[model samples]
Target: MMVAASEILKPTGQKPAALTIDGLSLEFPTYAGAIKALDDVTIEIGASEIVGLVGESGCGKSVTTMAATRLLPEGRYRVTAGSIRLFGRDPFAMDETELQDVRGKLVSTIFQEPMSALNPTIRIGRQLVGVIQRHEAVSEAEAERTARGILKDMLIAEPERIMRAYPFELSGGMRQRVLIAMAFSCNPGLIIADEPTTALDVTVQAVILRLILDRAKRTGTSVVFISHNIAVVSQLCDRLYVMYAGRIVESGPTRAVLEAPQHPYTQALLRCLPERVEPKAELEAIPGTVPNLLDPPPGCFYRPRCPEANDQCFAKPPSMAPAPDHIVACWRRETIQPSIKASEATQ
Candidate 1:
């Protein structure tokens, strides 16, 4: 295996940060020209921080993760430009074998679907053992022991028996736990969890999310948790990046972004939450749908949907700047205050 020797999850915590993505823009060449899936996307994850990439469906959040890991599928997608550096190594330039080592050993991932991720034909133990043995120079017996230990740590009961069973034999929650075990088995520096709880129930989701958080917190494993649920992001992320279309419209400390969103899109997203936001009141909703990415507008992609959008929004693009750690890309954010303020006045 060709695992990079410099991953950040070292026991001493002395390694450099896990990743740094700069002005990353990934485009897909369709028959209808380039679809700008990611427009100047930039974010970072420290060695031990859990950052949330929050956005609506098809906002390029998952695409960003897939591109960063060099896992983009055949012909359907192409990265026109951008840089994704993992442990200071460029993922885009790495060879296939090199990428494989980085994927399972240094940086692991958990997809939205657990059943598909876990092999149906193989026993759970065999799958786990394969993952470990793929990276480590260990005998089958040793690999099996390590795999069993990892599963047990994930709170999987009867690890020995569960390992011997197939993926179909386990419940959904159990299957998710097994996937989590696999991701963390290599002691990866970064875990890209792409909506890890989507297939799980509410209570099960909570348990799984908590497990992920507790594991990362204990292991000092940095995570890039991508989800469309703002409420969930509020609970788990130390920092939040709000994506609209293909760009980051707002970003800041989770509390700041959640409590006092600055951008029109951000405010709209908060308003769109279901009823009972406060102690005993119905929640407001954000009006309008997301912009089309295949043929994005001339200026701001959100102009059509932004309540505060004006001539300037259609004139030229707005740049990110001094909005505390918080940032808003709306042309009228300077004059746009969250409706939460106006709602209080009426009350």
Candidate 2:
């Protein structure tokens, strides 16, 4: 039986975040100069919440996840500021051996491309068994049996046959299922799914999303679900963080942000969704391109494209303004809400 996402809840009061990223700033050097990939980005995922990180390409969504996993390349990527804690422990401070133990065992990741993530040379069964044995003190036979059982749970038919087949032999959907099985096999406390369904068909995409949500709920695992599709994020996540130009422009409970977005960038994002358009009307697209990280705008990065931008936006960067459960980084957040409300009312 599949567990409902709503049923997965953290107990109230002082519970540490499963994953906490505080004032994280990362930069990469190039001939042009240093490019800030992330800038003072802060986010938190509770022990059992499925939080969605939504943004367009090059908004630093994937980079944030890589940083959380301690997978950022040395020398190429530098952490300029801030900290990342996984279940109360700083992953950055851990030694190589400790970091390895934290990965796969404490936190697992489902990459965007299953083909790239899985080894074509190794048989599927051996890969799954290897992950299980590495994290658990199980015999080879026991590990193989556990792998088969996990495949069965993922609704794969003939789990034994799949184990023997190489990654090249399976369909795209099957390969993704294998990766999901490997991720959940260790019962990791946190799972970072970085666009796990981007390559699959609509039907298969729905199935994969359900599997991830159900498995997370059943195991009480916190999930950071990253995606470019706002619709998909709205459907699956309890909370949402809207990223733009390497900064989180807005964030709040999924329903609140989706229903009445305050930031102009987030409002434009919603306007671009297909469902928001009338049958004959043209699809909306946000104007202007993502800012060049090598030389981003000094104040508000989205000021060039924001309809509500003004002199204040150009003079000083906007900080996160609290609004009930929502947090928006826009100087005009108060003034923008009424206009958005009127526009929504007209629609």
Say which candidate scores most in lDDT.
2
The deviation in Å at residue 165 for candidate 1 is 0.5
Task: Give, for candidate 1, the lowest lDDT window spanning 10 residues.
Answer: 1-10
lDDT of each: 0.81, 0.87
Give the candidate number with the greatest TM-score: 2
For candidate 1, the lDDT comes to 0.81
Task: Give one digit per residue, the lDDT tens place, for model 2 in 50-145.
Answer: 999999999999999899888988679889998888988998889889988889998999998999999999999999999999889999999999
User: What's the true lDDT of residue 23 in model 1?
Assistant: 76
Residue by residue across 266-305, what tens digits does model 1's lDDT show?
7777676653256557656566677667888878888887
The alpha-carbon lDDT assigned to residue 221 of candidate 1 equals 92
Q: For each candidate, what TM-score against the reference? A: 0.90, 0.93
